[model samples]
Target: MTTEEIEKVTERGPAASAGVTRRLGPATGRPSEASVLNVFSHGILVVWALMVGVPLLWVLWSAFKDSNGILTDPWGLPTVLHWENWSNAWNDANMGQYFVNTAIVVGGSVVGTMVLGSMAAYVLARFTFPGNRFIYYLFVAGMSFPVFMLVIPLFFVLRDFPGSSLLATYHGLILVYIAYSLPFTVFFMTAFFRTLPTSVAEAAMIDGASHTRTFFQVMVPMAKPGLISIGIFNFLGQWNQYLLPMVLNQQEDKYVLTQGLAMIALQQGYENDWGALMAGMMIAMLPVLIVYSIFQRQVQSGLTAGALK
Candidate 1:
C-alpha cells in the first residue's frame, strides 16, 4: 500500500478496535455499573414502599374488623366489615369533638402561618431593609431549636398570656401552632419567593397598584404552588403534633385529636375496644392522607421550583 493508504489503515485500526471493544463490552457476564445501580435503587424503593404501605394497609383493613378479629389475626384481612366501629369511635370515644377541634385549630394556624410567612418572605426576598438578613437568619435559626426545649417555657407563656390564659383553648392552641410552624414556613417561602419573577411585581407597581394590593392581588396568586405546598406541610405538622398540645392543652373537653387518640389508646387497653381505636386512628390519618393526595403534584412543583430557577 502507498504511504497515504498506510496512514488511513493506521487510523482505521484504532477505530475498528474501539468498535469491537464497544460491542463486546456488554457481552461479558458482568453487569454495567449503571444497570446495577438502577436495580439496587429500584429494589430499595420497593422495600421502602412496602415498609410504609404495609402498616397503612393494615390500619385501613383493621378499621373494618371487629376487636376479636384484630386480636386473633392481626395480619389477616377483615372477614366481616363492622361499620359501627366508625360511629363508636366518633361518638363513644369523643373522637368527633376532637376531630372538630383539630380542624379548627389546624385550619386557623395554617391560614395564619401562610399569611404571615408569605408576607415576611415577600419582603425579605423582594426588598432591601435594615436587619433583613438578620431577621431571615433568625427564622432559619428557629428551625434548628428543638421544640422539646421550648415546651416548658411555652406552657408558662400561654398560661400567663395577657388578657386570658391561652392554655387549653382552641385559639390558644391555634396561636401556638402558628408560632411552631412559622420558622420553617418563612424559610421555605423566602426561598420560593426569591425564585419568582420580579417583573410581574414591578409591573403591578407601575400600574398604580399599591404595595398591599400588589401583594394580595398580584403576587399571592403567582405564589399559589408554594402556598399550597407550605400549607400542606404546616397542616400535617400541626395536625400530628403531640407534645405541644399535650403540654399546653390540659382541658379534657378541648383536647385535640392526638390527645384524644392517646386517651382512647389508654382506655381501650382496659375496655378492649380495639376496633374503635383502630377506627379512630383511621379518622386521624384520613384527613392528612386525603390532603396530601390531592395536593401531591403542587407540593412537588413548589419544592422543585426554586431549584429549577
Candidate 2:
C-alpha cells in the first residue's frame, strides 16, 4: 500500500473507536444527559431539603433567642444564646412529670399494640378460618373511624368505673391508645406477614413446631422490620398526642408535652414568653426527630417491602 493509504486507514480506526466511545459513554464514562440530570435532580432535592430544614432552623434559632430578639428579629440570628431557657422550661413547666407521663402512655401502648397486633396478624395470615375476610375488613374499617366521634362515649365509659375514671391514669390512657393504634398496627403487620413465604411456616410445622411456636420463633424474627415500623408510628402518635391527653387528663401533672406547650404559650394573665415557648417546642420535637433518624431506614423499608407481593 502507498504511504498515504496506510496513514488514512490508521486514522479511520481511531476515528471509528472515538465514535464507538461516544455511543457507549453512559456505560463506560459520563454522558451529557447524566450530568444534566444529576444537576437538575440535586437542585430539586436541595429545594425540598430547604423546605423542610428552614422551619426547623427557625425553631432551633428561636430556642436560643430572648423575647426581645424574637420580637425584633423573628427570622434573624439570636444576639445571645439563652442556655437557661432549657433549664427554665424543664423546671417551670414541670416537664419532668410530663415526660414521665408521656413515657408511660407511649411505652405501654406500643408494647400492647405490638404483642396483640402481631398475634392477630399471624392468625389472620396463616390460618384459614371462618369470617377471615370479615375480620380483616373490620380492622380496615377501624382505620376510617373518627377518633373524635368516640371521645365522649369513651369518657363516659371510663367514668362509669366504681372509683377512679380513666381520667388521668397512665394505664387508662394506654388502653385507649392501644385500641386507637391497633387498627393500623394490625393492618401493617398483616400485610407484612402475608408477604412472607409460607414455606417457612410449613417447614416449622414439619419440625413439630406448633402454630404459636412457629410464629414466635420463626415468624417474629422475620417480622422485626414491621414491628419496628409499627412501634415507631405508635410511639410518635402517643407521645405527641394532645387531644386525648387534654381531654383524658385535665390535671396539669398528667399533661403531655404538646399540652404543656399550649399552657406555656397561653399564659393568660402574664405575658407569654415566646422564646421559652419555642424552646419547649424544640425540646418536645427532638425525641421524635431522634427516633425518626434512628429507625427511618427500617421504617421506610418495612413500609414498602410488603406492598410488592
Candidate 3:
C-alpha cells in the first residue's frame, strides 16, 4: 500500500493506472447524479399522481354503486354499473337546474372579470396619473382580506342595494363573483401589461388611433395570454363557489352545483343514498376536469410566458 504499489501501478501506464484508480472507489463516479435525481423526481411525481388519481377513480366507480354495495365493497369495482344513479342525481336531485344556474353565473362573472379587470390593468400599467398607485393598491387590498371577513358586510351591502335587493338574483351573484375575482385578475394582468412593449400602442396612436381603438386593437390583443390565464382562474373560482351562494342565494331554485351537492349530501341523513351523492360529485367534477384537460397547455403557457419576456 506504499511506494512499491504506487511505482508498480505507474509502470503499468496511464490506462492501467486509471483502471487501478477506478477499482479504488466507485466504478462509475458522480455522473449518475442526474439519473438518480431523475428517478427520484419521477418517483415523487408518480406518488403524487396516484394520491390524486386513486381518490378520483374511487369517486367515479362509486357513482355506479348503491349505498349497500359502496359501503360493503368500498375498494371494489362496480358489479351492476348502476347508471340510474346518474339519472337520479341529474333529474331527481335537480343537478340539471343547479348546473344551468352555475353555468350562467360563472360565465357572466368570468366575462365581466376579464373585461373590467383587463381595462383597469391597462390604465394602471400605462398611465401615470395622480392616485394611480393608490388605486392599484385599493384593488390589491381585496386580495389581502379573507372572503369570510367580507361576507357579513357584503351580505348587508347586497341586501340594501337600492329599492330591490340584489340578493339571490343572477346579476347580483355574478357581480359579487366579479368583485372578488378582480383583485387577483387585476394584479396578474397589471404585471403582464407592464411587461408588454409600449411601441405597439404608440405606433397605433401615431396612425390616428383613438385611445379606445388602441386599447381594443393593440393592447388587448397583445395581452391575450394574460387574459386567458386570469379568465381560467376566474372561471374555476366562480364555478366552484359555495359559501357566497349558500349565504346570499337563499332561494332554492337558484342553487349552483356546489350548493346542490351540499344539499344532496345533507339530505342523505340516516338512509343516505351514497351512490347518488357520488354521482352528483362526478357530475360537478366533469366540467372542471374537461376544462382543465382542454386548456391545460394554454393555462401553463399563458401564466408563465410573460415572465420570460
Separately for all candidates shown, the number of backbone clashes (residues 3 or more apart, or on different chains) is 0, 0, 0
For model 2, the superposed segments whose C-alpha errors exceed 4 Å read 1-48, 268-270, 300-309
Question: Which residue pairs overlap in candidate 2's backbone?
Answer: none
lDDT (Cα, tens digit) per residue for candidate 1, span 1-309: 266579999998997787567657766544456457867998999999999999989999999999988988899898789999999999988899999999999989989999988999989988998999999999879878988999988899999999999999989998888887888888888888888999998999999999999999999999987788788778778899999989999898898999999987776553478899899999999997887677776656654543563
**What C-alpha lDDT does candidate 3 achieve relative to the native structure?**
0.87
| Residues forming the 10-long window of minimal summed lDDT in candidate 3 | 300-309
Which regions of candidate 3 deviate over 4 angstroms? 1-45, 298-309
lDDT by residue for model 3 (1-309), tens: 366578887787886666566557664756367457867998999999999999999999999999898888899999899999999888888888888999999988899999999999999999999999999999988878988988999999999999889999999999999999888888888999999999989999999999999999999999887788778767777888889999899898999999989987877664888888899899999988887887887666654643563
State the displacement of the C-alpha of residue 234, model 1, in Å, after optimal TM-score superposition: 1.0
> Model 1 segments beyond 4 Å from truth?
1-28, 31-47, 268-270, 299-309
Tell me which of candidates 1 and 2 scores higher on lDDT: 1
Model 2's lDDT to the true fold?
A: 0.81
Best candidate (score: TM-score): 3
Indicate whether candidate 1 or candidate 3 has the larger lDDT: 3
